[model samples]
Target: MWRGLRVALVRERFTVDGVAALIGSAARAALDRGETTPARRAVRAAGAAGALVRLFLLGDVLPRDEVAAALDPVDVDEAVTAGLLDVDETGVRAALDLRPHADAGLPDAPPWWVLSDLEVAPGGRTADREHVLGTGAASLSLARATVRRPVDTLLDVGTGCGVQVLHASGHARDLTATDVSTRALQIARVTFALSGLEVECLAGPWLEPVAGRRFDQIVSNPPFVPGPPHVEHVYRDAGLGGDGASALLVGRLPAHLTEGGVAQLLASWLITSDDWTGRPRAWLGEAAEAAAPGGLDAWVVQRDVADPALHVGTWLRDAGVDPASPEGTALSERWLDWLAEAGVHAIGFGFVTLRRTAPDVAGTVVCEDLRQSHDDPLGPEIEAWLDRTAWLAARSDEALLDERLLVPDTVALERGLVSTDEGWSPVAATLVRLDGPQWRHDVDELGVALLGGCRGHLPLRDLLDLLALAHGRDADELARTAVPVVRDLVRHGMLTAVA
Candidate 1:
């Protein structure tokens, strides 16, 4: 039974750290690079864990007796009966990937023993339409970005192996997981059963499984891979061509969100117009329109963008196609040709977050690009920034001036000193906050000089006066100039309210 496997895994300390230790740092690092040879070698001496590392984790064949010993509390017979293992004349090999998964970014969350299709790292076949994914970077990104505040109900669309549900289960009162692939749903059910948790399972595309329903929260790391024509994988590529799947899911999200509900999704959208963020904003507007009186507020962050060529190659590689091969070259050509014809200059990858708010509250669509990598668990930072934006949107500059502000301790300032023929000239100043993304706001010298006093102790008028006195400038003019900068800084999270 799944319960028995769970117990055996716990007994064996089949944890992230445990596996890392058995494999050693080199092997671990190599594994991240998708090379399993080093890791394969490192786990050779690892007793029962070795068999598991061989049979399930690494997709290597293990002697039948070794598998029986490693999975003792949950016997090999059970694993075989449970469809987790396959025995052959040579030895026993994995039918799927089974490993301990934990996210250090979310320390409060429990670890999960995950089950899914094998990966390239384990020398498994290319992920097919029926493949169920184990936890990967995209899944981890969704987990890290999701605002972890407790909610009554949560829905996970495209719930591959139920990893998202596992992350959400502790917080949500009711959980519903949906997957288009029947095999994926089966694995997800196994995931929950092993964790001693229960979740309602549905089968269909996007939100079809949950018609005429709304939830407090929804999260999906759906099939957003913009594959070339006839891409086989269901886990990454939606049947609709040219990133249609991501658009449809995002467009319909607002209607299924309860008042104050937030949906977080990782998706890729095509770059059609001159602007990168334009289409995403339009999608948000459509979702808002669908929600009607209670419009959907959106904050979509485009994390990365790639040209058609690079995008095509990336997806080709993702599907485990050799770039040098004939098929890979042909696929790339077709996708690139399509992009060229369609005027798709680039493909933008990002997270789309839509919040359904009350009828009286006017909604907004914030679409921006952030290519830099920052720290993890940015949920609180996002919530803080969103709250700040809403507050700023409601207030005029005069009211904002009256409100004392303090920059959060996480913020740092940089005054760029350009080298010239004569001497160093302080040319630029950038205010940055630590929010897992370099949130940089440019401020002038006067704005830079006046920021030291922004400790929530002084009103805007007072800070301007102080700066004017220090700089021997007109206080009124200084106030006029600095108020807007401060407001912008506050909005961008470089400055925070004292409270």
Candidate 2:
């Protein structure tokens, strides 16, 4: 048993070329047979390829039980010493590292640690300190969540590990990736090459490579940590304080985006007491000045909030810095000092999606900060919310009554059905949660309903009067409660005002 386990480990490390070829061939064949569609094929290939790559690095540590209980103490020791197995005894794992194509100003020679067979380290003792290629959950989140759209070109600013480039390859016919670190571009190239995708990886600051190029889609996961700056990592720092880097990057988008183009990004922002809205809005002003006067739709969704210390600590850990270590402690001190110096106390993290289009085109800019379950994003709920809003925003009380619709017996605020931002146009309905669904309100059942009753003939005001009479509520009170709800529904597309 020990001999067989040792053999398996050797095959995983790719140290034994014959075993590696066999593992690679089997995994590839399995993936090919499993894939039925392009999406499935991509998923299968990525998973199978990653597994095969891991086997080469982490083979020696495979549990003895899984391999007929053959692992010996010496085999485990040798594997650990060789840097192919992790320190943890039970859960052996491999780091997924990648880089883009060459000519991105990265070093021509690969890392000595990388084994020749799969061109990656075989459990080499390498610390992921550098802001190199992406191999994190957030990076994958951005990659997978991105939906393909019609676009002439795409830009990935601050492209690390070129994960964005890898995902963007399928969507954008032409792709350009930029990073301040030439080393990052180098890594991005390696990743892209291994994955069999081509992208123009540039070694430069954000938007520098394509100073005048216009793209239909632009996506970035910029260095969004807010802090003071001295020495900076090209992938992270913008020589600014809390969310300063994000501002700096966002402030540069309008001129770079083509007409009717959209830019989606995840970033962090400092929440100020004065007005949370003004800070991010300032980016739009800067963008407008850089390009032609056009329609701009900005949607900023704040997903999470954290205090300065928590924020700093989270980022420090993310960069693989050990706070317990002397160097890590010093780095942490510097980060805290930077935040203090920046006049920032708390930070908000979330997404910002912007669309640049023609003026006079029906477009909108929405900023919302809401509590949501991150683990379960209700895509269907959001879709339903949108559908209800569309129906509401398009019709008037009279029209709604004419349709002779039955009001739902009850409505609950299941999650989100309202616009949190001010200055939105109004719709003429109320949002109520129902049994496993959301629906409109019954006009007759509602006492002093904000919207008119569905009497099948009466205009909105008369229906309100009828409701008012039934409920013994005054006109002023009823109007105050109902008009805004109606307006909100209209604005939100929950109810429609007749054209």
Candidate 3:
């Protein structure tokens, strides 16, 4: 049935690009924003594809004959029996939210369809306990942030509807998806079957299903919501109090990863004080001690932070509860009170990337806030980060200085200019990266001169000696001071060692 449905979808050109062509970009954008009226209007005259669009994407009731025509090879009776559609005297409607998805980050990757339970409209009733989620912002963010190099095997923990598996298929050789909810696993099966991809599905919580087994890469957008120790929705709440789900994965996932394996996860942590990294840092430290002698290299990037009230309200709305309603007010009060008692002033949402290192090597843990807008895919940057950090870890100051270095074109030196009586003068200089994290570093005259001399032509030691001579400073002292500064630049990709 799934094969037949796949064929029919292909025959009808029910794909991401195909749908966009049928409906204008404006309608597509509106659909992404959760408004389907524009799409319904645009596809009103569209033909068989239009019928499918209306029935499936827009959640509209279409004439039975029209839906049948749209899904030609697969009979309407078969579709209904397969639980893909519902038929009644009024018309036929989609039983599931099946929509075309193409990884915009991977342009050459093939398009696929995702199958999951329908989304609840704003102010609609709350979702069921086991509701399977479709492609959402969290999943898309993890997809863009994942390091997508070719790997022997990949595992997606909490594989809700298998959207991440679809994104991983292009690079990973073997795929496995695990979910605690059997209903989600079932829906993920349908999603994979319809896309003509094979993935092993296991039902378990966190890393239990994959215990004692390791993979090259592991990715998850788990149920990381922080609240009371109760499960309201299996798709969001983990039934563990106060961001325990995120900590659980961070602690245990390293052991389930192969040597040099990488795990990318979307997680949320509680912020009790000004030290936002405190919780995550402790989690990584504990995980490192438990994993192996080599430990784990971790990078936690906090993308957003929300106060307790706003966080509670946001999640309440997500659960289809109106904050203005009496029920919403009661729930919000209880949740906020719980947070206050627990000393959770805010909630931090971010990406956690961990790499299992060799037993002989020490691991690096970096925690920082990066709330800036990133328009491009972060996979390359993340991969480069791991590589750069590894390179820095393997070298000493003397070894690093002996090597020549060059700055990539992506690194630009921006000068802050102020209008003076004579002319515009440079007051401050900052090094800005045009790509990946867009890190900016303030520099002084010596820092600027040092970087200027790094042209991949001479060793850094020689360049530092020249700078010291020009500035009338001791070469040994300058080198000692410059090593750490150069290491920071290299760690952030502003400076590259010439090879």
Model number with the top TM-score = 3
- For residues 380-446, could you state the per-residue lDDT of candidate 2 as single tens digits? 3333333354454455544544343223334332222346577443334335534322334433236
Residue-level lDDT of model 1, residues 1-499, one tens digit each, is 8887887777676878778888889988888887989988887788888777767666788888888788888777678777888787888888778888776655666557788877763443475668777888789888888877889999999998999888887679899999888999999998888776789999987899999999999999988876554548888778677777778888898888899898999989888888887777767767888777796678888888998878877777777887668987887787788778777888999888888888877776778777777665657666766687678767777787777888788899988898999899888988888655668888777777778888889887788888889889998887777777776677678777775
By lDDT, the better pick of 2 and 3 is: 3
Candidate 2 similarity to native, TM-score: 0.62
**Roughly what TM-score does model 3 have, to 2 decimal places?**
0.96
Cα lDDT, all candidates? 0.81, 0.55, 0.90
Q: Which stretches of candidate 3 lie over 4 Å from their true place?
A: 105-108, 121-123, 417-426
Across residues 1-499, which tens digit of lDDT does each residue of candidate 3 receive? 8888899889888999999999999999999898999999998788899998988888888888898788888899999998888888898988788999998767887669999988883348655889888998889889989998999999999999999999999999999999999999999999999887989999998888988899999999999999988898998899999999999999888888888999999999999988999999989977797569666889999999999999999888888889989999999888998899999989999999999999977898999889998877777889999999999888988899899999889999999899999999999999999988999999999999999989999999999999999989999999999998898899899999888
For residue 209, model 1's alpha carbon misses the true position, in angstroms, by: 1.3
TM-scores for the candidates: 0.90, 0.62, 0.96
Q: Considering lDDT, which of the candidate structures 1 and 2 is the better prediction for this target?
A: 1
